[model samples]
Target: MTAIALKSTLWSLSIKPFKRKGGTNLLLNASDLALGLRGIGWNWSQVHLAPETRPTSSKTTFVLWTLASLCLHIPVFDALHYAVQSFGPTTFGTINGGSIFDDTLSPLLRYSRSTFISFLSGLVIYCAIRITYDVATVFGIVVLRQHPTQWPPIFNSPWRATSLSQFWSKRWHQLFRDFFVGVGGVPMTYMFGRIGGVLGTFFISGLLHDVGLWGMGKGSDAVCMIGFFIMMGFGVILEGFWRKVTGHRVDGWIGWIWMCTWLLGWLNLLVNAWAAKGLIGSLFIPDAQRLPVKIFGPLS
Candidate 1:
């Protein structure tokens, strides 16, 4: 609710008065004014129509793609449910001890286990976000008769991203882009220029994510959560420096390795923090619906 309120306030500050085609004013009609405000206010992504709207054939193609995405994510989500239960919560456990890794296993094996858990947890999060957005797209296009352009994909192939900046700006979900710009980037830009805006945007993002953790009972870990995001901001800056020196964009096999190393290296901090707070153990999916959980009855 706090997040929604922040977005709403930003929207009100940014929105302009409604206009219509052929010089007619939507402001004159009370019903039209209310509907327009509601629609624009609710669209968090701020997807807008281009001068040339898509044809019906494009809509059909979108529906097919959305269906394919849903098919791919459902079974992956189920398997993730199984894997997470098998591993138990807290990959490295708490600072005082009591983690899944606190066993008689070799140090190398424990590190590998923790890495696998971190990647698994990240995949589950990605699947959940994709599935929810895909379902919403289907409902909007099929049931509500909305245009395909209005329901653009929430993600843009994040796995293909070769740099932190590309990953955050182009590949990742952009539902909060304007919110971050409004609350952090724009204000900081006035005082400290573009780089400051970049840093500020990430700082605010980290703070809000921790706030979300706080809302989820015992999930807040400001140090890990905020530190991870700030590090990402610095990573983006480092990439920019590399581009300046090399005169080449971050891409291809080498860039992919660098990106993976950067992300996976720091991923444990955020994932383990959530695990320690009991976020991973929370019943996200009911056992009856999870095939492996139903058969094995949850490993630990």
Candidate 2:
């Protein structure tokens, strides 16, 4: 039945780039289009690529996935809450005449606790978000027959990242990576080469974080996050220089130790600020109620 189907009079019925010859069947044509995109579509700038897909997940598998995400999220949230403070007017952004140093906790205890919290927040939160997103993407693409594939581009085994540069560029959550690069890196590089690009990218990220804090009504404290990214930009430059000098990157267990130490050692600066503003503790019970019973259940 050669009817006037898929020939949109309002729009141009141009052929797609991936269609094979003599494939007039609209259903098969669409399927080929999807497969073609899934195979070749990639964005190096954002480092996002489609992953291989299964036919569909079983109903039980999908349910289990969701339950796992929720189950994991509670503990993740609790840990984050312990590391930081509850959200208040000052929970995110920095305020005048206030310092996390001024908090009651001594430097020893504060640093130790905040450092542990940071690790948990970094690891668990990223995983939780990834699992949840992938599950949804799977359902939409495979189950409902909507999108092409379900691979996500956010975190990519960041815990395995051997260096700060790799962590930021290749592994860590890269949701805003392309945005920062395009808005700041590209033009700055054109103007002043790679260094300019790095500075611009980190600067833009800092501004974005500050703006986000403001949007959340915590604009009063923006310096800490800004400083954090700016420092990261410089660290990247230093690492690049080191690589050029040494002809190799800081890799392996030694590199991992270096990376974690470098990040966590200075974490007190940012963590303190986050704690002061209650951003770290914004998820669950207050520090006083950080007991397992309060977080889990009544001793059952």
Candidate 3:
């Protein structure tokens, strides 16, 4: 099958069960449970075009998807953040302080420092929460398979892959990526190249996220929205260069570069967390408590 077709099949398979009774199965067929499955599947397949997947006209489907996402996301993100805090060496204070430095230099330098720092802090917190949720899910899946009753639903399986690209493809929100691919990927690829396609997809995804968060009165989310775009842009350029140098095949030195790229992406989680914490504390903490802040300069 073609790449788009394969993506469509995967999307359909992943979301089909939600349309069924009890939302417990993955098969797709004509049934009351599949009420909005067609819309979801068609949208993912690029067969249906709408301003957005959650059309205003389909109040029922929109509500269902929103509620479902909330239920699933809340617990997962909470646990993920908890895991990082409890196990990771770095503290939240350090992360907030570090983020300040990130914003001080970003395009937001034109904006108020306080406002930029505040938004960056919120983004870091949100990302930490998401990471916690993902990690907890993985732990849950592994333990549950051997002793189902011993583990509560508090955690879930980690995504299916360990690498950054794999994580992007499998662990992160599939619907979000699929929607971007359908809406923007083809045009970007046609206009620029594969690198442009990836970067454009991520950039638009960031903007969409920012707009949504802004509309909901959460201006802080824009930090993450912008951060994602920047990171993805850098990644796309790096990947393109690597592909060209490696003759489109990763082997020998090319493999090493690829591995390093993946490692750098994962390390960004810690780097970003540090930057965010640094930024937040700089704004809220008192001068007396600012010694550590100054020493770390926002990444303390």
Q: Each candidate: RMSD to true structure? A: 5.3, 9.4, 13.6
Write model 3 residue lDDT over 71-138, tens digit each, in one string: 66554443333333322225333332333232435655523443333343334455544445334434
The local distance difference test score of model 2 is: 0.56
- Give per-residue CA lDDT, model 2, range 43-156, as digits (tens): 222344433333334545544554565567656655544433322225332232133443567978866766765565455457556656656555654565543323334456
In order, what lDDT does every prediction score? 0.69, 0.56, 0.43
* Candidate rank order under lDDT: 1, 2, 3
Q: For residues 144-185, could you state the per-residue lDDT of candidate 1 as single tens digits?
A: 666675565566777898778878887777766666767777
Return the top candidate by TM-score: 1
What is candidate 3's CA lDDT for residue 38? 23
For model 1, state the Cα shift of residue 154 in Å.
1.4
Clash pairs, model 1 backbone:
none
Greater TM-score among 2 and 3 belongs to 2
TM-score of each: 0.78, 0.65, 0.40
Which one wins by lDDT: 1 or 2? 1
Which residue segments of model 2 deviate by more than 4 Å? Answer: 1-45, 48-67, 79-110, 124-128, 131-148, 283-300
Each candidate: how many clashes?
Answer: 0, 9, 31
